[model samples]
Target: MVDAHRTFVIVGGGLAGAKAAETLRAEGFSGRVILLGDERDHPYERPPLSKGYLSGKEDRDSVFVHETAWYAGADIELHLGQPVTSLDREARAVQLGDGTVVHYDKLLLATGAEPRRLHVPGTDLAGVHHLRRLAHADRLRNVLAALGRDNGHLVIAGAGWIGLEVAAAARGYGAEVTVMEPEPTPLHQVVGPELGQIFTDLHSDHGVRFHFGVRLTEIIGQDGLVLAVRTDDGEEHPAHDVLAAIGAAPRTALAETSGLAMAPRADGGGIAVDASLRTSDPHIFAAGDVANVDHPLLGARLRVEHWANALNSGPAAARAMLGQEVSYDRVPYFFSDQYDLGLEYSGWAPPGSYDQVVIRGDAGKREFIAFWLKDRRVLAGMNVNVWDVTETVQGLIRSGRQIDPDALADPSVPLETLS
Candidate 1:
């Protein structure tokens, strides 16, 4: 039973914060639960912001984690548009932007990350945007629709998941698209060259131009609106709009101010936490993108900014908050929907960590399951357009057993049999 006198406060209004509040209630905690968020809107999922929402296929209300009534029903004090400015661990209180102070018996920092801004010249122009929130996606949708009607060009400054997804969406809206990447191949660092080439081919077949091994130096604008992007190769890509999808940095100001231990800069620079998601102070916990957890599977600390991490880590942090000794050991999982490709990846292995990649299906057709192996043991697996095999793939990695490469590559061989 929870101590009703104790107050549980969650800082953040994202998916992880909402999930943590829900978990506390589900675990029979009747304590005072408060969720504070900086945004005016309620907690919401962000994946569709670049794909379905930007293309106008999904409605705004669909992104929310819960209906507004649910918060009151669960006795959760929903504090929206109130940014927490400082965390006073000694006082056990959090100060809001409006000077409101709330004391908590236990605190969960689910503060998610923010997009890394592009500092190139003219990036502050009107036609340039970054997709991290609903408002950004809505504005981009309008720009895409206008470009679609006028046959305008949309220049994207990164070829990562967000950039590629936005490119696909812009193309669907009839906007001519160009994607620029600093690397030789997009997603090469994550999925390797061979698989990354497949995506390049996919985008190329759809008429999206790519400038590989080039850096975006400036955003050229006319009348304070983005007109083009100039790259290091001295090539100019015409643009009606520009999107910087480079990456994100953790929102760690609150944690830092609270004097919490932080991870190393190379390890994604987040609040350092143990396997139980507890920070230095036993009463305070951290989760989601802001948390650099000592991952059991990786045998090192990792801070994952994907949707799956937020979804799984929230409840685990809540369990730890409720005096339960629980470890957030779920393997990292992420998926992307770009044009015809529905990709699902499970587990984690840094680039160059795996020795061999064995495929079970046709790569040319984009219908395949590829396994990344180290010492003949599965380290990670990705299913491209393959159905209902995620659990099986994750099972293989969890089992940590060596298997014949021939069996891994054979389509008729059941993955369950490999164990």
Candidate 2:
């Protein structure tokens, strides 16, 4: 059992860090719990940044993880807008941005990620934005609302979830949007080409143009504001604004500088940890996007950048920190809302890992469950516009039993039968 007197410090005040602090207190740890976040706002949800919040359907306070009173009542010291500068492993101290050193008996690094910035020329121009922080979302939301019911051109670089969702929201605001992707299809790496085409069709049907197999070469500006985007194909697409949604990189500089062992470069470069989320230093643990854990299900070290992982991993880390035996073997899961489609995906199978995809419902109808299988065993499953089946889908992946392809692709055969 962990001594109640030990001070526990948690860095990064995003959902993961907040969840860790909540877990520590809820698990009967009477120790001092301190959460340090660089942002001015308290721990908040990021998923809404692209959906309800960005579209003006939700307000600012709805995004927060908790109200101000919860932290004080929990006896958790909340340090907002204090960026941690360095970690001294031997000294058991963390240096803040203001050069103030704080000591702790145990530390948890839940530092999330930042949107990968575009490197092309003219990226600094006005009206070119990337949605990551609340402030950024607020600005974009204002822009979209100002152009309400009027057609404006929005040039989006990279057709990932953020780009696509923003495109949908812009369309709702009467903006003519165009998305460019280097891949042949959007999100082909995560979901296979077949499933990716469904999204492409959905966007195309709504008049969102696509420039596949193309890269943004430059952002053209007039009077220090974005006017157009130039692609490598020598075509310049005029735009009133631009959004670069390539992807995100984990904030691992603190761990890297502190000499924490990193995962193999192929696993996307995060602090390496075992199934229990324990870092090389037993006193320290890493969770959320900053942690590249060895997953027993995938049988490989994988780094997941999803809200579900962020919410679940911290509690597992807290339990393990308290000397309770724990293994975070939960199947990876994530969801996306694009236009009218609501998608929930469970289990993780990297590209080329799954042999085939079995569809149990019609893709054209936009309501169905698709299963990715390898060696006749389910690897992952996705439900689109379908309700209350995620647990059953996860159960199918965990069962590890050979399943009939015909039955897997038939709606008449219940999922529980396969399990």
Q: Which regions of candidate 1 are displaced past 4 Å?
A: 1-4
In angstroms, the error of model 2 at 360 is 0.6
Winning candidate number (lDDT): 1
Q: Taking the tens digit of each residue's C-alpha lDDT, what string does model 1 give over 57-134?
A: 999988999999999999999999999999999999999999999999999999999999988899889998899987
Each candidate's TM vs. the true structure?
Answer: 0.98, 0.98
TM-score of 1: 0.98
Task: Give the C-alpha lDDT of model 1.
Answer: 0.91
Q: Which pairs of residues collide in model 2?
A: none
lDDT over C-alpha atoms for residue 8 of model 2: 92
Residue 371 displacement (Å), model 2: 1.0
